[model samples]
Target: METILEFISKHIEMFYLIILMIFVGIELIGHVPSVLHTPLMSGANAIHGVVIIGSIIVMGQAHEIISLILGFIAVIMGTLNVVGGFVVTDRMLEMFKKKK
Candidate 1:
């Protein structure tokens, strides 16, 4: 408990920044028109693809157990995000196809 408090105190600014980003992201996303969602998600997918590669590199270089674990989790989450984004984008694109 003491260690957690110390850690939080040490990184208080980072925590605040993260909280601020979350709120800003929520507001920005909420205001995006539905027509823009596909393009936005494609951009996000590209970003997450980079994240997945970076996480894999981190996992390969990680010597500590905690670092390895966190890197693995990051890779998994990034992969999921990328795959889900592609799936959604594909479905969205399908809607534009004319009937057979």
Candidate 2:
């Protein structure tokens, strides 16, 4: 467990990015039915929110200035992707709705 944590701590940025890419690839592969795509994407986007908040916590705990700064940047970028993705997903869903 400790070893896993150490590796994760050392390579957190890569880990976060890999997870994000996996979600994106899943979305791109068209496994989600069109009817469920937006909700699925929105749900998946929440994962980024977790990454952002987690990075914030890590930044607060970090002692090294460089790591702290990088973590802070990660928080901002991750949050934008999460929130903006949800908004975009919602719009995509709305586009499929029948017009009045």
Clashing pairs for predicted structure model 1, backbone only: none
- Residue-wise C-alpha lDDT for candidate 2, range 18-90, written one tens digit per residue: 9998898777756656778557768678655777778878878889989988888988888897888778777
Q: How much lDDT does each candidate structure score?
A: 0.81, 0.79
Once fitted onto the true fold, the runs of candidate 1 whose alpha carbons sit more than 4 angstroms away are 1-48
Each candidate's TM vs. the true structure? 0.53, 0.53
Q: Please estimate how well model 2 matches the true structure, expressed as its whole-model Cα lDDT.
A: 0.79
Write candidate 1's Cα lDDT for 10-49 as tens digits. Answer: 9999999999998987987888878878767775675556
**Candidate 1 overall lDDT versus native:** 0.81
